[model samples]
Target: MNKLKVAVIGCGAISRLRHIPEYAANPNVEIVAFCDPNIERAKQYAETYKGRAYSDYETMLKQEHPDAVSVCTPNSLHARTAIAVAEAGAHVLVEKPIASTEAEALAMIDAARAKGVYLMVAQNQRMMPEHVRAKELVDSGRLGKVLTFRTSFGYSGPENWSVEGNGTWFYSKDKAIMGVTADLGVHKADLIRWLLNDEVSEVASFVGTIHKGGTDLDDNAICILRMKGGAMGSLAASWTYYGEADNSTVLYCENGVMKVGTHPEDQIILEMRDGTVERYRADDIATNAGQQSSGIIDAFIDSILTQTPPPIPGEEGLRSLKVVLAAFESQTSGKIVRMT
Candidate 1:
């Protein structure tokens, strides 16, 4: 079997922690090039992976000609980089929230389609064994009717994501465009949508920075989602949670409730109304669990080799982004925003 040649476009923390390591471990992938605006970082990554290095993507695209590229840039730069790589005839695995806006996401989609290359959003949570199992339980009618759900994702802000610390690009309204709602909110939105197998048609939300000093972006947020099946759900995301606890999701059904998060060996917990509880732990879950970037890389390879659709397409990512955006809009308007 021929290994798929791939490039790591942004040699940042995400690339180092997720993409590079995951691809290195995978037998079917070859690290062909590393590109980063920071030349030193690119060189470092190339050295680490035994790949060529370039500070400019065009040079890398022309020289290495990889089969795929991972766009691990900031939220604002996702669309442009994705389109450029796809135009270079390499499939794109873009980091999520897809893009800052629907228009940008659609443009990327159009570019990828026109170039006859695949464009997939790296929505890794969907690949978590716990999440997959939960969705399976819901879809298999084992959970019966899902009445309501409360899901949340969060972490302390990245250590050096920006120069401003808490007031970095993540907090900058101009660069980030959205805050924790964009960072962590999108994950919960995607998870609930996948679990319910429906889109959020309407949303009402409240988002603000109650903590995370100097950060202009919201440190905390709560949103109510109305799914197409009349299932009412709530999503809460935050960057203010201190210590080790990070991401968590809970789904309440007519029969039972399911829970999963950062727990080791007992990530999935099911509680029933009958005072009985069951716990499930799957070894198939990725080491990073929900870091999402690695899953996206693996899925991109599958899409390229097998010609199968990615677990998370750009459109699906766009939908999740739309939900997060609608939540922000609703927070501003103080009314339910239809996700049209």
Candidate 2:
């Protein structure tokens, strides 16, 4: 097996918890470089991960020329950073929301296409065991066509989980773009599209910033999705859950209702209209700050090794981002926004 040299830009919490550890665990990967604007943070991560540390990603890329790099940066930097990594002849796996804007996401995808380098979005929910099972059920005609669905993903906020412990860039408008909508909502958007195997046709939303402090951007959003194939769904994202995070989804189909991530133990439960009950079990979804293996790193490394396209490519990320962006647009226009 040819090992791919891997570098990580932005040695923040996500890098610490997910990217570095997962790559380190993969036998097909070599941890090469760690970069962060904060020199101390970079050095500390490098010390622990056995990678060279640098404050500048460009310098690291120029010297190492790693075969694969993960961009765990702020939403605003994803496009430019991933584009640069691709242009430098390396495959990139970017943290999600893809970018702050649709155009930027498209540019990143175009650059990768032009360079013949693989680009994947870190939409890890698709890798959740129960969700994967749900897809199988959907495709098996067990669900008999989903008619409606609802999903929610929420947590306290990013203040405590960040590498800085607080004052993370997530609160800033310039860096975060739209707070919880980008942070938590995008994941659900991707998950829904993957489960239904359809794009959203239109979206209407009411976005708010009710509970978070030190932020001007929205921290909560409720969006209604009309799927291209005649399914109706709703999604809610919030940083004001107050209690433990709520990360759950339920799909209503012709034959039954699919409940996922709802209970503590039952990862997947099916309830048929004929008063039949079925339960499917799998591992829980990984939290961004958790140490559990995301299954993304191994999957991503496998893609680069076999010269196969990533499981969640840049275009797929763009689709999810467009839904979130359209929600923001809907809030401003006070009308359902058509996803063009």
Candidate 3:
């Protein structure tokens, strides 16, 4: 079997921590190229991973002609990079908030479709073990219909997670575009949409910059979502979480309530209307403090190799992104934004 030639753009923290390592672990993948604006960083990764490094992605794409590429660039660059990769006839696994705008995302999807290649968004939360089990429980009808939910994702800030630390592009409005809202909020938006298998029909939000000083982007956001199925929920994303990162969700259903990622030992907790309680232990949820395989790379590789659509395809990503975008609109307008 010919190993799938893969390349990574933007040798940032995400590339170093998740994309490169995950690809290296896949027996079916061969790292062929690495690209970053900082050529030295790219060269370092190339030296360690046995790939050629380039400062320009276009040059790398032209020369290497990889089978697939991971677009780990800043949020604003995702669309342009992914569209170029698709046009180059390579599959794309782009980092989340797939594009800065819905129009950009649609263009990327169209490019991939026209080129007969796959375009996947890296929404890793859906692949987390605990979330997977929670999905199963929800689908099993054991928890009945989810009527309400509260999902939150919070951490110290991107300064702690990014390779550039305090100077990371995450703190730049032009580069990041949306701070915690896009960085962390999109994950829960995707997760909730996927977990309930429902669309968010309406959104109202309060997004603001609370603690962070360097950037004008929001450091905290609280959004209220109304699903098409009549289920309602609140989603919070924050960079103001002082101590440990919190990625937890609770679902109130007709028959019971389900809690996920709230406890250290038991990742999922269930309370029944019949006065019964259940606990489940799954693999720990991946966080900056305790990193784990996201399963995104493997799934992206499998989709390319099998000639199937990716699990989190461009459309699904766009759907989740719409929720985030709506929240932004609601925050600015002080009114509920309804999705059409």
Candidate achieving the largest TM-score:
3
Relative to the unseen true structure, what is the C-alpha lDDT of residue 253 in candidate 3, on a scale of 0 to 100? 100
Give lDDT tens digits, candidate 1, residues 223-279.
Answer: 998998888988888776666546677788888887776466787888888879888
Task: Please name the candidate that would achieve the greatest lDDT relative to the true structure.
Answer: 3
Candidate 2 residue-wise lDDT at 176: 77
- Report, for all candidates in order, the number of backbone clashes: 0, 0, 0
Candidate 1 Cα outliers beyond 4 Å, as residue runs: 160-168, 262-264, 283-294
* Global Cα lDDT for candidate 2: 0.90
- Candidates 2 and 3, the one with greater TM-score: 3
Candidate 3: worst-modelled 10 consecutive residues by lDDT: 301-310
Model 2's C-alpha root-mean-square deviation from the true structure amounts to 1.1
lDDT of each: 0.81, 0.90, 0.95
Q: Candidate 1 vs candidate 2: which has greater TM-score?
A: 2
Output the better candidate (1/3) by TM-score. Answer: 3
Q: In model 2, where is the ten-residue run with the lowest total lDDT?
A: 284-293
Q: Write the per-residue lDDT of candidate 3 for residues 188-251, one digit (tens) a residue.
A: 9999999999999999999999999979999999999999999999999999999989999999
Error of 1 at 42 (Å): 0.9
Once fitted onto the true fold, the runs of candidate 2 whose alpha carbons sit more than 4 angstroms away are: 288-290
